[model samples]
Target chain A: MARVNATPRRRGAARTDELLEVTLELAVEVGYAGLSIEAVARRAGVGKHTIYRRWPSKAALLLDALSRVWTADLNYRGTGDVRADLREQFLRSAPALATTPIGPVYRAVIAEAQSDEALRATLHEMFLANVEQSTLDRITRAQQAGELVPDVDLTFAAEVLCGALYYRGLLSTRPIDEAAVDSLLDMFMAAYGA
Target chain B: MARVNATPRRRGAARTDELLEVTLELAVEVGYAGLSIEAVARRAGVGKHTIYRRWPSKAALLLDALSRVWTADLNYRGTGDVRADLREQFLRSAPALATTPIGPVYRAVIAEAQSDEALRATLHEMFLANVEQSTLDRITRAQQAGELVPDVDLTFAAEVLCGALYYRGLLSTRPIDEAAVDSLLDMFMAAYGA
Candidate 1:
């Protein structure tokens, strides 16, 4: 009786997973310009209304897809070494940024967001939330502990650290290697370290 | 005789200018995905063959259009003062980066460049030329004068300075205002000042 009840729930989860997987694959193959709900529906073998039921718009669907795959292993813990902590954060995130489908999807969405207000808001909100909750708090803690300069703007510091990575990933073909990671952390520490 | 000789040349130049203008406008309105040689030709009131004669592909046409309008007034002459120089550079370039048609066109091409390899090379080449010739040279000069640390990587320094602006312009809706300008210069100074 319990198995019977769980069967439909499991089936629904599997269907949602399949739809998301298709969206990720299609985003790269067709790009944001060529992507559409109808295309996703046709490719995924799901109804258009099924996608709309899960996400209000195509942008929302893409955002959901991005969130699931883009940030899978990005868990940062501060170990009192700000440089090491920041370096680790980037080193861990580098693979997803460089070689994965996440890179293309991120570039596509950001490119789309230039002309898209709704999508821009979603990206900004999601980005700011992550920075505020994790990055800002960590930096602020370091300031309190006298590990970082008291006057540094946490947001700007975060931007400088991560912006180089995003800049390279989006605009340049430069690999996000150990050297790049060291340069980013070294520069951030040079400016902000106490 | 000279007037007659120049008539066709002048007319050809005017026709090319019009086609390029339409291309720039359409890139923002419809984005790189929807932009086409047909649309540009139609909007410019020229034959499709005229556009083809001038540019070999959509990417080529877009690159040509971008080169004409963008970077028109970006003249960076750095003085001895690093803060003043950096601030002036950003100030000078802000109009092109934000207010003009150049911004949208630039954003559009960059969006397109993600999926297009040849376009990416063009962008990187153009970007690297500007940075290496002007930005990196100025920073290196300052370092030599003992205005900045000797060990600072000029390329990374240039990337950090401009990457923040590009990051905000492309990804976030943050206005590149006076405070932001001051913050960028100050941070660079903090890190590299001798």
Candidate 2:
């Protein structure tokens, strides 16, 4: 995947990146309902035809924008330690949820997906696949190293780990502090440890 | 607090409940922005004065209606075990998130609360308080029973436990299943267990 801030010197690539950036900005400002290709073009100083040439629909554009922005820091080094990996993975995710525009955009997209079937499918394919994969990979490594119970449900465990953080960031008014992160890691280890 | 569907024998109470019911129905249909006392009266076969005599504004009426309908399940029991209590509590909550109209109302209210402080305050005071209180009570009891570590941060732990479910239900299109609930409980146990 291309670096998020990589400037596109090529004309076509620059235009595409500009369109995605405008789309994301509009999504934050006015929400998914208020976003449009025309608005994005106006914001980006591009034409509607340029946007249409690259993307099929507003949902398609939105999905591409989301995918471009959502780079997970999946750099977990398995030192034969499952608990450490889980903690590291969660630590990476916590900052993303707190510091990025992706958090609010993520909330808007999920709200949009509730009503838009095509968008829902697209989001699931683009976002959910990678998240589930990263989680499953970590759990599988842990299980293989005998750090976790052999019969532990990997998919369910992953969701619970990520799901707890998701709950805090999007749903609760409180911030996800270091203590909360450590507690989550502690909880995971207690439940899944061999 | 009154029973959610308590019969109102008094004329005033009956009329109040009737108006609140109309408000809830309209909120569900048209969302918070489109809901108004005039529209609610029209829908309920009542007058504007009838609404004003009770709630001072649309926000107040919506808050009252939400309070009445958005009660959480207080079905958790510690049994001197934090893990078992969490599993049972979430199992009960999972169904409510998946099958209840309260789920949509919660989503709509949360989205609206992003911009409206009065509504947000009322929601926190009336609706969220119940949830927070119930969860905190369970955690506190577990701490006293030595099921949880003495130094376990009750407030943060509560957020981790509840925030995850709230995040998944409000943000994700996917259902909150039993397996997810179990995994969360396991994580909680791992973190806070004595």
Candidate 3:
């Protein structure tokens, strides 16, 4: 009886995952300039109202799709050592550079945000806030554990981590590989670690 | 006779400077979206032909105008110490944040660069090359002076410095102040200085 009930649940989950995957593939193919709710609905084989029921606008749908596609490994705790934890986190997340269309999508969004106030606010609230909060949480925990220097400014440190990653992503065409991540971790630790 | 010739030379230089200033002002008001060579010529009180004689196209004119306007003081010589040199260089350049529309203009150019491949290559060659070159020069000098660590990757260090500044400028409306510059220098030194 339990196995029978699990069949429907698994099917539902698979359907949702398929929808998200289709949305991401469309975003990459058309760029953000060509993204529309109706287009996403058509591409995903889902109804316009169905997509609208889950996401209010194209921006909301894009954000939702991004969240589903670009899942970072938040479990970066490694032997309670901050440096190792950061290196591991960066390495795991770094592969998204090749697998996802996140870099180009982010650039397109930022470009539009320059002229569109609503998109700007949405980007700040959805993307920037998520990155900032997660980084701060990790750094603050490290500080409390005496792994980071007592006097290190947690906010600035958080900015440095995200800023470096963002800088590499936007400016360069190269993938953010393990070597770059390792060097960044080493630099950050040398600068702020206790 | 000498006095008359000197007066004419001084006036010509002053007029050229005024034209450049007006060009930047017009760019900010209209953006790259609506900017035209004729408009710039009218705004600067110069003949359209004269503008074209100097620059073949509107893009060329804007590039020349930007070159005259966006001047960073790259006189950072090694003080026989990498940390101090980095600190001084950042401190000196920090105040230009308020005095110039570099951030907005740069964002505009970068956005335009995405679609216009020719303009993109020209922008990289005319503007970005100088920035990268100056940064690498500083790092190279520091390396030669034995101020930087033997294994320090100058390319990565240069990226970290300029990349952080570009990141903040493009992503946020926040002013990059002296304190922020100081913190950045501190971190850079901690990471790369011997």
Candidate 4:
């Protein structure tokens, strides 16, 4: 009886994965503007209600698809050097943003969030806030370790470092290449380095 | 003879202004997703061909509308203080972005550009490039004036300064208020100050 009950739960989880996979595939091919629930359902061979029952809107569906695959490993190595660690994190994550479907999909969500207050808040709570908090934690650790200026508020510093990259990469349409990262780090070192 | 020739020219310019005004009104009310050429033409009371003749696409029409009204005065009031000049420019421009239709419209265009390559290039060329150039110019002048560190690349410095504000104001949904400005300026002073 226990096995019989668990079988249905396992099947449900697999269905969720299949739906999310289909969502990402459609998102990459058609983009946010071109994507729709009917289209996704058609491609996935599932009823539109199946998707709607799970996700209220396209944006919500995309967010889930992104959350599943867009796991940017923010594990700071704490290699005894803050600047190198930051540079490592950025360089390591560059390919995830630039080369993958996550890049375009993520950009679309951010674009949609401009006019969407609720989506914006959800995005912040689900994604950006966590990235920011991790960055802040690393910065705080660096300050404690005497690699950064002690007792000075590093709130703006964290924002600037992360914000500048987002600006160049997303806003300015500039490629966030190695050179750009180096230049950003140089400015960071000058500002926050002990 | 001169007056007769100028009559058509003046009327054409007036008609253009009226069309653009209608476009802004519709954009603010419905937003980018709900906006369309059919609606714009119906509201403007002009035939669809009339708008199509002038603008190849909705993105083009919105760009023109934005360029006309989004005249952010970037003339850095060179008080020989680089930090103060930047702070003044940011603070002065805050309301123009935060309170006006320019803010929402600009955000919409930036959002659309993520999917449209040609539109992205046009936006960068028409708007963001000028802003970045002027910022670089101001920074160069500051470096020359010895108010900032000399011989530094200052390229990333400029991007970071401008980019940070853009990130906070647009991407992160944070207000570019006085306190935020103060914190950014503090980081700038700590990093690049002579």
For every prediction, compared with the true complex, DockQ reads 0.48, 0.34, 0.34, 0.57
Q: Could you arrange the candidates by TM-score from highest to lowest?
A: 4, 1, 2, 3
Cα misplacement distance, residue B55 of candidate 1 (Å): 7.3
Please state every model's RMSD to the true fold in angstroms: 5.2, 6.0, 5.4, 4.9
Better-scoring candidate (lDDT), 1 or 3: 1
lDDT of 2 by residue, B41-97 (tens): 999988889789877788778877876664546557757677777787777766654
Instruction: State which docking tier applies to candidate 2.
Output: acceptable
> What is candidate 3's CAPRI-style docking category based on DockQ?
acceptable
lDDT of 2 at B62: 82
lDDT of 3: 0.70
Report how far off residue B162 is in candidate 1 (Å).
Answer: 1.3
State the TM-score for model 2: 0.72
Highest lDDT: which candidate?
4
* B1-194: candidate 1 lDDT, tens digit per residue: 99998999998888888888898888878867788999998988778998898788787787777667645434566677877887877877765556645676666777777766677777776553465356777788889988999976767777777777777677676777788788777777877888
Per-residue error (Å), model 1, residue A42: 8.4
Write the residue-wise lDDT of candidate 4 on A1-194 in tens digits.
99989999999999998988898999899887788989989988999999999898887888777777756655767888888889888778665545666788788888888767778777766677666777788889999999998988888788888788887766665788889999988887788889
Q: How far does residue B113 in candidate 1 sit from its true spot (Å)?
A: 0.6
Looking at model 1, residue B159 earns an lDDT score of: 74
Which candidate has the top score in TM-score? Answer: 4
Where model 4 places Cα greater than 4 Å from the true spot, the runs are A1-26, A33-61, B1-61
Native-contact recovery for every candidate?
0.50, 0.40, 0.26, 0.69
TM-score of each prediction: 0.77, 0.72, 0.69, 0.78
